[model samples]
Target chain A: MNLALVTSRDTDQAVRVASPLAVRGMTVSYGQTPAIFSVDMTVRAGAMTAVVGPNGAGKSTLLKAALGVIAPLAGSVTVFGQPMAAMRDRIAYVPQRTSVDWDFPVRVIDVVMMGMYRKLGLLGRVRGQHKALAQDCLDRVGMADFAHRQIGQLSGGQQQRVFLARALAQEADIYVLDEPFAGVDAATEKAIIAVLQGLRDAGKTVLAVHHDLATVPDYFDDVVLLNTQVVAAGPVAEAFTEANLQAAYGGRLTTARVDPESVAG
Target chain B: MGAEFVALSLPPILIGVLVAVACALPGNFLLLRGQALIGDAISHVVLPGIVVAFLLTGLVATGPMLLGAAGAAVIAVVAIEAVRRLGKIEAGAAMGVIFTAMFAGGVLLLEQSDTSSVHLDVEHALYGNLESLIWLDATGWGSLLDPVALAGLPVELPRMALALLVIAVFVGLFWRPLALSTFDEGFARGLGIRTAPLGLALVIMSAIAAVAAFDAVGSIIVIAMFICPPAAARMMTNRLGHQVAWSVVFAVLAAVSGYVLAGYGPLWIGAQASVSAAGMIATVSGIILGLAAVAGPHRTRNG
Candidate 1:
């Protein structure tokens, strides 16, 4: 099943003909200043890949670019060996919690129903079947009880779970999440990580823009260290090393101390 | 005198209902999108456009004047977009600046033009005449496809027919996109809905509604028809579809009531009065808005 087109000097460097998710030479700019520069990455099917980087490291930009939310100044992104536009329905995006106005007057059920909007189109009213599916997704995220409650009424962790339910309702093969764990409690974090693991176990590829480095070893099988460009990417054991962390952090590590609780987690 | 009153006032009242229905259709979309002020701005700013069209054509025709007003409203939208994109101005702020400047320019143009003899005064533009509407065509319904006729009903079918067509078109063409975009523009964009085109179409429709009201009620009063009914309906319901329905019902009621009241109000008060049909309808709509504001359900929590 491993179709390697070319064998390089390093056996690990062979270029495969197909990848579930592939981004090559991606560059993104905000107005005049470039935020991400020529980044290359890939996520194999049925794997959980975590993207870790410092602030302003363009972690969120990379996910947004992959989802076609932000146009890349350079390079291309593909899903299931097809362009993003062609496979849009097959990709689910969980934007950062802060990106949306939580105070918007919509119930959790309504927010979850938004996931079906792509298939439903503008006029396709959410009927019984769609509501059932939304309920199922919410139940899977343990938010079924709060289905009727407005999203703004929920706690921070509960709000994150609601967003998870939204993405879950999409039923997409690939998932892209930006800081799903930020500001969430331990129990909620564990629940979300379990959901991500369940997705990978179900033979789906998941790419998460993560901040907590401590959970990386336990939660993800693959890692991509980004500092504007991909510093390293591969299996977690080999790719996430102290030297690679230093390369990603550089001199910023000298002045800053990594929280023991964060590293120990 | 009673029959004379009905003869002179009925056509304008019917026309006002049509104008309110048209404006309300687009007004729901604008209010939902948090762009409610746009209608008010367009009504004020289109004054110069109407005057210029009259000056160039040397005729006070409704068609050319509406076309000119629509063109100016489109320009204002473009200017707002440009200001937002280039200068990083807030959308509301940009709209405020563009409309105020355009309106001031229109007032200046009105002062400079020899339009007094032609009845192109700013007051006439602000408050239009329903008195002369009898001279306008209110016939030709028998030639239409509908052959079922009420022989002796004193109804102006031509005007009613035109109003129905405008309402049907507004609801048919823009129902879905308007609802989706109004709720969340980003989500609408994600679903491949072209918000800019939808927004432009809505603005154009608003200008048309304003023009229609301008002839029957006047430009200043058109603001009430567009804003008050929708605002009142919004306070009563959170659902966009329901709000739209309520707005139409409210507008039609206000139009009929205002027309009837304006007709008998003078005799009842024992005073000689010539209250504009449009102004009375606008006043009624404003009163409804105030009542809605006072009686609306209060939400202690956000959402």
Candidate 2:
């Protein structure tokens, strides 16, 4: 291999060591009950990491707290070795599809343009280049034709694609998605995984709260098995084991099993 | 028109239109956010605000009244949030409880106070004296060009105009952020949009509109203008920009048509006296909303 290739490979290893997202002793509570308590996780750079757990396992809560979408009761989150506030521009977040009002009066393009709000700043007009960029992002998710349509007119899968297109428009270094595959069609899942893989291939980090355990081995390179606390976290082959899943999901996961080939990797 | 028209009809029509447009502007976002009753709540509480202001100052000054009403609006919002959080009540229930209690307290204060000389009665608070605010110095349409005649305009007219301008500027300056946050608060927050403060700012602007409109148009017209025009406009368009434009048109249409009908509809029926202009304005807006609900192109959600 060339010297440039070898140097880049060494840098990739270094980047993997230094994580894109690191949660240190995070504890969150809703009212009197704690949602996530004293949980810690480190997301590897240039790889897609799946956060899989049972329902009510605080998967969404942990992601929200880590991204500062909701304030944590205690502890801190660092993005790319810096505080979230300082490194906000480097992160792109896609919330749950149901988190927004579907009937809101905005076109698909308008929703996608919102991703560029930080760069546009207050009072900045949407020029032609911005529109072109947004359209290009939509094209990536097979949603370019729906750009002129009202957001509510789309099907659930199309809506998910539009949301992913919006995140793509953000052009951030780290992509964080919350249940991106939930409620979406199989086609949308395939399209989304392809986009995420493209992001990883481009040396960007991705962290997703995944619900389908069956797809974890095929989709994610790293895994964080969580149940209000970190049960196991590392490379998928090492951490996403049947024992770790059993410990994390307890008796809730009855049918999920680790693929032997995936573990052998 | 003649001097009679200039002296009798101009100021109230202008003020009425201004109040309607002001309230309807913020009403669009409020209706979309499912907080339509916030307008209703703010209008009701303004009675207490003005009453306390009049009680304190012993003079029916515009400054004290506006200040008092804004204060009451803030208190009502805070109280509603407190009740929803601490008392574990839903927002609608909390709003209903606080606004009605404050309104009842205001009526009690009005009855107990010895200010029978001023125009601060409960009926005036509800219906407003839109017909009574006439311009005496205007001689004709020539008054439009005469600075001296224009200077003698009703204070409420200029105040309402200024309030409408402020509200319009606010909505304009924050249109993108407001649309993003109102549509998806979590996504907006992730983008570092400071959605909480933006929501509070929106409420404050709504309160300002409520207080300004309440001073001239009464709580009836304030509540009607806040919900009816925007809700009607919503049925007419799927685009927010179009909805806002349609709302302004509907507000103006309601104000002008309602004023004319209230003034002339009685004469057409051979009645000597005019009806309450504020009530007529509200009725006209409700009628517009009813029509839009029935026949507007985008009335249904699927459209």
Share of true Cα-Cα contacts across chains kept by each model? 0.16, 0.61
Top-DockQ candidate index: 2
TM-score for predicted model 1 compared with the true structure: 0.83
State which candidate has the highest lDDT.
Answer: 2
Q: Please write out the lDDT profile of model 1 over residues A1-81, one tens digit for every residue.
A: 134433441232332225667888899988787889999898877899999988899999888777666678998876666
Q: Which tens-of-lDDT digit does each residue in B1-303 have in candidate 2?
A: 799999999999999999999999989998888788999999999888898999999999889998998899999999988898798877789989999999999889988998799978888778888998899999999998999998999989988999999999999999988888888888888888898788878888889888887877788999999999999998887788999999999999999999999999999999999899999999999999999999998877744
Which 10 residues in a row give candidate 1 chain B its minimum summed lDDT?
Answer: B135-144
Question: lDDT for model 2, on a 0 to 1 scale?
Answer: 0.89
Docking class of 1: acceptable
Candidate 1 lDDT over B126-218, as tens digits, reads: 777755554122234432223432332223334334655775686666666665566555544544567787887777777667755665557
